[model samples]
Target: MYNDLSNEELFGPSDYSETSDSESNNEVSPCSFNEPINNISYTTFPSISGLILYENLLSHKQQNELINGIVEANYFDNPESNQAMCFGTLPSFLLNAIEIISRVPGLFPDEIQNREPLFDQACSIINLYKPGEGIASHVDLPRFEDGIVVISLLSSCVMQFKPLSVIEQGDDNNDNASYYNKFKDIQNTDEPIPIILRPGSVLALSGSSRYNWTHGIEENEIDEAGDEKIIRNIRVSVTLRKMKQDQLLLNKDDSNSFSLEVKKREH
Candidate 1:
């Protein structure tokens, strides 16, 4: 759906764009960063019900540019977690990447389009993970729309997902207590499945996989990949999400108010 020639006009020319004949040829190479990840090459993790993985979704050059762009931008510390993060609207430089990601066929549930505009107002977060740093196992809050995409850069790490039912049940009156207790019997029998997230790779969590499971990375300096122990480097994750309906309504109201103020001033 994206016209490469029109990209320059719409979002301005990005340094990561393919500009030469040689670079264009490299786009078809599996190892090249210019190559786009499509459904034919996409794979789903059988172990985790709805976890989809796209290898090399961003080329090496693109990955480097994304990392550099986020680094050059402002990032705030996350007060709720150990990992420092910043949340804001996506920058223009990153729009090209978002357009590319939006074109990935069958990336979301069919109902996603009916519920809201996908990527209309792109919201994103840049998370910085240091050596031995990782997030706890938790489900994404319901405030975000269904599909959650995370692009990994700089290092490869193992992400583990476990069914939320496996957690110990708390107060019975708690809203989610019943949901958690329903699978309590399966807790001992169920094992957390690990997925290796390499640099330039994209991980899409949706449907049951997004709500029913808790995902996290172990706080280890190194991750074991097959027989190799991959040392952890400073990694950055750029997560893209859509705001829920209520949030969208608030934004619409705020926009209308600003427009009214501007019109009054002009009159």
Candidate 2:
């Protein structure tokens, strides 16, 4: 069904704005949170730059509301789509989630005061995953700028990140089997950094972490997190990004070729 839709149609609108009159031009305080929120923990990976995780960012009630909204909206009604996207303004249910993310100090830059504190032009991609289904290692589309944010819901899983060199030696056709093999082949010298993403956690990627690393999940019903094994369940990830101005109208194939150009440039 989305085949006939333009990129603008796939997303809400290309000119969509996240800024509001009330938030416009107001200087945000450095300490946005008045009191320390319980169960909140911030972490970073030394091996990967600009990789940040904010655990327990949403409470149980808030997480439930978001999950309920996504399900009720039928964003993934078509079994084939798997992914749904929203641009500009967000649904009413997600307004509070974005507000909370915006308050995280230095999570998003304040130089762009006219737009939303989070991103210049915000877009969200909602992805649904069934048990045992996992994504392959790949860099995010270069059409999107840095500062990729992902919010996990409903289950816990390990996301593995490897350097671009690992992917650069693989086939461009994106054969998942070969990719997985390559992932396992470098365990000793270049072990992939595994990050545990639990429900209600937010992961942000930027700089080298965003461009020079490939992240993916292995296909398995159970995942190893630390010394414990986590059983996979129905999970949803909401990824937020700032779209590049010129790439708004690119079709799927165009985006793929553009990604190739990015990879070539990295070499």
Candidate 3:
């Protein structure tokens, strides 16, 4: 992974708050999401689902091997942003997905107009999910001042945005204060919309749905084969964005560990 650099800082840790306090409101919406032009399903989180099928980006021979690697990465890597990122052999589909996302304008007029390409920078992320493999609710804090663009491939999951982490960091596991606040906030919807993204579906999580909203896919529940059998989902996702301007890319071979200070990024 990451060019076999043994000393590469795998990922920034969870406590790393690497953005400055200068915040600007970025208005975004899923408006263009429903248009027939893209033929893309425009569904809100935990609310809707659809299918977008792209042709073979990879040959039959290549798909078999790469798919297995994608599955393995999701199982072995940490979901937290401040941990080792899952970097395995990327499928052709994942790369193409990011290429498409990189060019698409932002969801809202303001989002893309202010920041073309809508983000300072971005990257590709592929994930795997076995039965009971779920990501708990968490705001993509700090770095997400600019939203994340996620394109889903292979399987589908209920991705929803509401609220979480409303109390002191401690004891939040049992408390519903944060949960309820988020629930109340989005109660106006006739129903909760969980975007069920199947393979080939591209979703841009920018708009009013940016960092202001928190979304995650519930653990997959499909255990087709026995425990001995390694059946699982191979989902490729690319999180493209405008990184905080002036923030230094974490040098892979940079031996700058043990210094976990959050750097202030000037706009």
Best prediction by lDDT: 2
Number of colliding residue pairs in each model: 1, 0, 19
Q: Which portions of model 2 miss their true places by more than 4 Å?
A: 1-39, 108-117, 120-122, 166-189, 248-267
What is the TM-score of each predicted model, taking all chains together? 0.68, 0.68, 0.47
**Alpha-carbon runs more than 4 Å astray in model 1:** 1-40, 74-89, 113-116, 120-122, 166-189, 250-267
List, residue by residue over 169-203, the lDDT tens digit for candidate 1.
Answer: 22223233443334334444467776777676678
Which clashing pairs does model 1 show? 33-59
Residues 1-267 of candidate 3: C-alpha lDDT, one tens digit per residue? 233312112111112111121121222222122232332223233321111112222222223334445545443344432111322223444444344445444343454545644543233333444435655544443433445655444444445555333342222232334542443343333332344443334555544455444566555564221122222343444444544443325423354322221111110
Local distance difference test, per candidate? 0.57, 0.62, 0.37
**Residue lDDT tens for model 2, 44-159:** 67778877776666655566677788888777676655666665556766666666666666553345222444552345777777778777776676667677788887777888
Which candidate, 2 or 3, would have the higher TM-score against the true structure? 2
